[model samples]
Target chain A: MTRFVVSVHIVPRQGLLDPQGKAVADSLRTLGFAGVRDVHVGRHVVLELDAADAASAERAVREMCSHLLANPVTEDFELAGVRPA
Target chain B: MKVGVVSFPGSNCDEDALLAIVERLHESAVLLWHKDHDLQGADVVILPGGFSYGDYLRSGAIARFSPIMQEVVAHARRGGPVIGFCNGFQIACEAGLLPGALLRNVSLQFRSMPVTLRVETSQTVFTNAATAGARLTMPIAHGDGRFTADADTLTRLESEGQVVFRYVNAAGEPTEAANPNGSMRNIAGVCNPGGTVVGMMPHPERALEPLLGSTDGLVLFESLLASVKA
Candidate 1:
């Protein structure tokens, strides 16, 4: 079995309001970090599993995102990348 | 009629909801664990408030996958009544049984107080007891109760009369000062397109008894009973 390391990034949908992200952005400005605009908060999930192949692995991770990892109503998820570890 | 209250590991309001259903509503209520897949033949399903799954990774993000949610979603799809309060509201939205999402309070504080809610419409199973424009008092307790949705979805919900409740003043006017969570359009509660599923951030179950200083929350349960009988 090939062990694959999958990366999932979940972000609040663009149109939805993000209070936490706004807080962070404001805090960054106070710390002298300039040019930070429109900051958004999101979750990064990593999964290690065995799959038949890369195609199967991608499919499995995609299911996980829709079914559990990410909420479609408020959040959007991306299969950032997958690699063999 | 039987009411099913689904309890997750961190659901602290399950017992309160049970008491409200059995003692005040005088209806048979069952406790369905999150791990269990069966709904126990409940005529109505309620996802009571509380920090389910410790509010980890996001409120209701993890608990939405609980086995019983599958049945709850199916129940709503079949035109059965389903009500979600607070954290339960978050789960319902996460499960796609309802539209929009509960965002963090703009103030970033855990707000716990009674607020006036205007009945936007009594056309659904959950709000049938109130007159269309009547105002009711209910308590809201949460740090992430701001309702947000895309412009198209928001317009659709408004045009479809799916917005069941809105934060309002004692005079029954939706005012910016009365909105505690900065929710879009001062929205306090909403229902699915089919009108069978509901999700609200306020804790109506917490305000049902007079000893708790108010009885305005009872109307929702009463409406449910009335709808079930009809």
Candidate 2:
């Protein structure tokens, strides 16, 4: 078994109303950044655990996202990366 | 009928819910701790509003895994009545007791105020006593209260009459100004397809007394009692 660090990114699903993200985008535009078309603020979670390999680690984290970390109705989750801890 | 109010860690409204049942409704009630494995034989369960698990990893997410929730879910699956208020609504959604999710308020503010709701349906166990189209005044205190679902689910919920309450104006019109949280279609409450599980962002327990600014919330408890009796 190897100790692996997994990073997961959970974001509000596309096309849904993200008020916090919109507020931040508006603030950025107010600060003179015109290229900001949209912003969807989300959560980044990092986890370290033992797994047989990177594939199993990623799979486990994906299950975690689906089951607990990310809300299927309002958010989408992606495994950002997996590295040896 | 005996009602059980689940008291999750960080739950602030459990007492209010209990009082609503015991003091106002004149019914027996019990507080079921989140870690408990039993419902204590409660006929109905209430997930009262509060920042469960400190709202970490989203409201109600962690609380969904509480040991008591297993029994609650089993009870709900057996067609037992369950109601979720405010943060409880978030928890119910996370628990999949009800469809859709409650998102951050569109205003990006924690709105603590009284809002008007129109009873969209009276068929659910929670709203059976309310007349369809009846206007109710209740308090909503939350930062994440927006009700959202995919377009297909939204269409289905409306077609199937699962939407139980709607934010409305003084005249009972569902207008933009009346929507407190920018919930889709001004939805303030909804029920499961079986009508056994209900969830709403407003705090009915807090509105049960005239001293609390309104007795409109009493009707909800009355409805539940009526359903149980029938």
Give the true-contact fraction for every prediction, in order. 0.78, 1.00
DockQ of each two-chain model: 0.66, 0.96
Candidate 2 residue-wise lDDT, B88-108, digit = tens: 999999999999999889999
Model 2 lDDT on a 0 to 1 scale: 0.94
lDDT of each: 0.90, 0.94
| Leading candidate by lDDT | 2
Q: Which CAPRI level is candidate 1? A: medium
How many clashes does the backbone of model 2 have? 0
For candidate 1, write residues A1-85 as lDDT tens digits.
Answer: 7999999999988867778899999999999998889799899999999999988999999998887787767789999899986
Worst 10 residues of 1 chain A by lDDT: A65-74
User: Candidate 1 — which residues are off by over 4 angstroms?
Assistant: none
Interface RMSD of each: 1.6, 0.5
Q: What's the i-RMS for candidate 2 in angstroms?
A: 0.5
Candidate 2 lDDT, A1-85, residue by residue in tens: 9999999999999989888999999999999999999998999999999999999999999999999999999899988999999
